[model samples]
Target chain A: MDTVCSINNLARCLVEGGFSPDLANLLTLLGGVVLVATIPLVTVIFLIWIERKVAARVQDRLGPNRVGPVGLLQTVADALKMLTKEDITPTGADKFIYNLAPVIAFATVILMWAVVPFTPLHIGADVGIGVLYFMAVASIGTVKIMVAGWSSNNKYALLGAFRTIAQLLSYEVPLVLSLLIPVMLAGTMSLQGITEAQGGMWYLFIAPVAAFLFYVANLAETGRAPFDLLEAESEIIAGYNIEYSGFKWGMFMASEFLHAFTAALFFAIIFMGGWWGPFVQEVPLLGALYLVGKTAIVYVFGLVLRATVPRVRIDQLMALNWKFLVPLAIANVLVIAFLIQVLKALGLMPVPGADIIAHLPMTVVMLLGNLVIIAVAMQVLRNQGREEKMAQEARMAARQQRVVKEVRTPAGAPVGD
Target chain B: MLEFNASTVAFVVMTLFILGGALGVVTTRNLIHATLYLILSLFGVAGYFVLLSAPFLAAVQVLVYIGAIAILIVFAVMLTRSMTRMSEILNGQWLLSAIVGAGLFLLLVIGVILPTWGNGGLLDATVSAPSQVVIDTVDLGKALVDRNGFVLPFEVASLLLTAAMIGAIVIARDDTE
Candidate 1:
């Protein structure tokens, strides 16, 4: 089963076919690096087109229908334009650092793909610390944004970068905390191992709240709507990348597009039983298709959210992360850990078996726990809403009374009245 | 004569990153630039951890140190507008600090070299062993939680972290009154 997509098997086959060992190994490594790099670059072209189409549809307008079938070549044309446009460097800006930031931003996301398991056989490294690698590489992005903002020598860019770092840092707590559920449940940090462990059932059913927290945190991490203060187009005029032009600006856009999709991909892999479908284990290429299919679905969901939701105030963003998501993530982790331990003790924990139906009992228990957590969260949200409503009504009533008193006092009214 | 092997090349490149970044950190007048150099140095340290077959440590190094701590340091640096463009790279304590730094470097070099020199053959034997032992992530996870392992220390560390977090929040909060 593991042999189907494995680069090791391919290398061995090459060796058996009379290729030198060193050459085979080198070729395999090179092929993997190339594949990982190309997948995102190629996909971003399509992703941008899809994002525009989706956003347009949601806004009740006709998207690109020119250049190719339904404007498919729009991104390609954009890429061409970006390539030909003038590259400008602002005077007094730190030129080297400013130039380096976009490359860093683009490269960091690609580095994350190095750990992504596309199919059973198609992993780059399959490192023991795969999940952590994703987090670590993603974190490097903050530095890149900082460099971009700081080196721009512009106040708005600096403010945008500041907001970005604050939002990213605040949300990272819950992001990491939510990731612990899968790590704990699978008992492995390896993404492939997590995927394989979910052979019986996806972690989404087992830990819905954790998955939800991860999704929200990821949205914030990617600076998507409700958390898009990083750019907040109307306010900061493109935030960190305002000074960048041409393909340098295009690279930042591409990285943002790639980052959003990457978050969805990670969500699919960790929670949605990545590459687990009919005959995927037998035919590994099918696994790749399944992964892509799931990632697209998740990606579209994120796009919908982006197009629909209003951006949150920076204070609200911070409060949501620190007060709500962080605590909820922590509580969810504790609940899951305790439940797992208790289930194991009672010998009620289901084995990772081929039969997906056998997972129902365990799933039901987890679902119940998730329900409790969700209920608590709803209660908190309802309370906050009620308090706001009451405060608004009180202010309205006080204003009305003041208006009536003013009318009663003839001196307070206009002399003509 | 140039004898090229993978590890040696990697080691040499990583050493350059470490040394160059450390040099940049100390000599750069711009605080933000210094912080970026510090990240580069930290990244090199993480690479060393990977070379040492401690990938978990390397990940932790990146996740905690580079990700959280370095970012926090940069955040702090950026917040103070005046600190970003420093007029001086060296202060009054430069000479004394240089001497102390040199002394510390010498001591560390000697400490590392003396033991390595004594155990060079043993180290080579271990390195050339057919099956090099590796501590996997599972073992680390288990060790952290097991009663006879590091459970006590681990819990205490968490408690300390929580306390520190609370203290930070309290100190940072604005006084409404």
Candidate 2:
């Protein structure tokens, strides 16, 4: 007689209605699956409209308003249009793999929701290794890109896939490294466990550097602004999905948009004390509201950044990941690990399940540690920038000197022009 | 005593994926097709790890094998112009490879299977039921770093990997620079 509409309660109701226990359980399980799967798919339609509206606002233009109220039904109209569009398979394409790529791409994102804790009592599956489950499912996306690129029988598609893979693979290093911070703090990889561990204090306050690293890496992972080289329309002509059309192409777009919002949701859950507002325990549904509110804030921040920032060059993207984010992330993890040990030895470590006030000392110390690391990293980056600028100036001076020498000689051209 | 359960059906499906993908890998003429088939086979192995109730191992399998290694293999194949399309599936060293593969398979059968041939049961003696044991990931992490556990070998393996990475960088360095 539980009031909550949870799977267990539903199963119990079915059992009381004369169904066998196993059959009731099976039906409830199926219903839960449908519920979990459809939530993302349904929400993604609205997410698209929101993304367009936000982007429009950022660029000082009105977004879709022709369809329903504030263009709310625009995504639905687009979906219908996509449905009626011609589905074309290019000549010389690997038809089977080509067709399967979009399905895998879209399915991989949805699979991640299987472990997401929407509320305290409403997780799809409380997998033991939920964080790793996310990482594993995301990794499958690389395979989909490869399959799509290779099977498309288009050079642009292949090249796009190659660049996208490089970006995705490189960012995954920092992404996984930053993910370790929360896992270490929580002492568990399960998303629910992490959320529960954040009850006392959000990890964002304890380890803002890790949160930043995770956010940046995820931005690159999702191919958002400054890292959207995967589909640099001016360069590779739509990249990996260039050969796709109709609903197949639409699926890729949906997954991309959905993946961005999913990253935000994970950020909220892991770092921002997901569903942990006041009275969340008393009203479980309030937890869902709090989670969504936090997620929307993060998601809108991402959209604004996307609209504002220009895309980075491939070389710059690689250099940033390798030289900047990866080292910073590694150092952040090591520093946090060391600080935790120091706090433990000093007997200043907050006990598990302590209140927020009890966590203040540890939070302050960890926050100071993060600020120090950030300071040091910023100083190092400034020095590197100065050195590179000096070298560029010196090279320019030498080039000018050579030009002058060539002008005086008039017979000999520049040696290495 | 085996019941017709969900896991049994899943196992059958996973076996089909593994065997079918492996067969496709060796039989396909297209190198990219072969790589895709190899990914399918690796995914099947990950499925088996899940069935074994080692979700951590399964995630690692997908993350490392399919995500990193398979992508590397595909990258290498794409880089080589002539490797994408193979004129023939078999090479002149097929006989040698076949002999080596068969010998290794036989060795596995002897080394692994022969010891437990007539035991209480093959699977029962090897793999405990999922409900029988629960190994938390925290314990696994502790075991990797514990002084009484595998700390030494773990550090050595990490050092070896670092050295190998440095070696790769050196070999791939541009001489023109």
Candidate 3:
């Protein structure tokens, strides 16, 4: 009876009720796919509304107050407007690819949900390589952006796509490397397996540096503020989707909102003991609630950061990813791997026990190691910042001296001026 | 007669994707369209991996080929001004290349595929394959890192990738001085 909530169990029931086996299986699979797809799509409307309200509050203004109570139905109204809006196809755009990009962009993010574990038993597929599946599907998103940019036949769109590729590809290194820590700790790539392993202790406590790296890289992955040079409106004129209009453009925006929220949910699932709370084991519905609640908290935190931080320069963005996060992520993985091996050799690893509290000693050791890593990373960043600042000052002084000399000279300009 | 097994249907769909996408890739005049078709073809290959029950390999195929390699190709396509609009996609050597490509195709079908799947061969009807053994992700992870497994090869691969990355950066860097 407790297993009735599972898709497999429902399939069995359908078979017993005299449906053909093939039909039953197909129906069950389709049902699961529909459920997984609907989750992100349905939530995206609310996500946009919440984001606007949050941004408005951050900027000291009343957001959408006309649609419904507290402007809850604003997204609904916006959707209607989007549907009725005239779809524009730019004059030199590749007809097929220009139309395909939005669908692919939206579909790829939804594909990621196929592996996300909403509860202990309510996952879509529970594929063995769930983490890699997420990364792979997310990578297809880069292709979608490229197609959008190229098909638009606009220079700004192409530039935006170039930035998207560089940023997404560069950040993927740290994202995948940091992801390795959780996979190593759990000894499984399955998202469900990772979450279940966290039954004892959250990976966030054990690998805080890895978690931070994952968060930063994924923030860039979503092209949010401080890492959002891809769609920096002042610079690239809304990036790859500049020429899109109507529902096609809406699809791109919805995918972005969905991707941001999905990153938060993934962070919760990987590092924050997703769907793990009191009585969740007995009541699976409660697990779903806990997962959503934790995801919302993380999502709100991301929103606040987006509202507060200014966008980074393109060069700075690339340097921050390639030079800083990549090395730090690699070093963090190596140290954590070594620490795990050492702990196992010393017979200090916590024995598998039913009580979640039994894993305290192991958690503490990993937490202390993570603290050391974070401290070292901070020291490195501080030194790098100081050096950069000093160099900038020196350059400015030299330029000022050159200006003074040029002004003092009778000639208006020097040879190299 | 139509056979309606799940795997059979999946195989047909994936085959259509692979062939259609391959056709699209070669026939398209636009470089960007060709790249998009290339992605479709790579995706079809990934789908084939999934059908073969190699989910990890499928993910890697998508991640590397479509995600990284295909995108890099598109990036290169967009950078060059004259390459994007190549009206003459084929050159004077088209006939010779076509002949060679057809010969290679025939060689692959005759020498590699046919003998392996012929009657009483490795993939014949009499040869009942062994029962499926579900290999967990943990085993895959261990095999990559274990001393007797693929640790050395994996490390070497990583080293090679790092070297290639460094080489690429050095080649791409513009030193005006």
Across B40-90, the per-residue lDDT of candidate 2 in tens digits comes to 999999999999878899999999999999999998887777888778654
Top DockQ: which candidate number?
3
Instruction: Give the worst 10-residue stretch by lDDT in candidate 3 chain B.
Output: B125-134
Best-matching candidate per TM-score: 2
Candidate 2 per-residue lDDT over residues A126-190, each given as its tens digit: 89899999999999989989999989999999999999999999999999999999998998899
Candidate 3 C-alpha lDDT tens digits along A18-83: 899999989989988898889888999999999999999999999998999999999999999999
User: Per-residue error at A184 for model 2, in Å?
Assistant: 0.8
lDDT of 3 by residue, B25-50 (tens): 87878787788788888888999999
- Top model number, lDDT: 2
**Alpha carbon deviation, residue B109, candidate 2 (Å):** 1.8
Candidate 3 fnat reads 1.00
Worst 10-residue lDDT window for candidate 1 chain A reads A1-10
DockQ of each model vs. true complex = 0.71, 0.85, 0.89
Model 1 ranges with Cα > 4 A deviation: A1-20, A402-417, B1-4, B119-134, B170-177
DockQ of 2: 0.85
- The residue pairs that clash in candidate 3, if any, are none
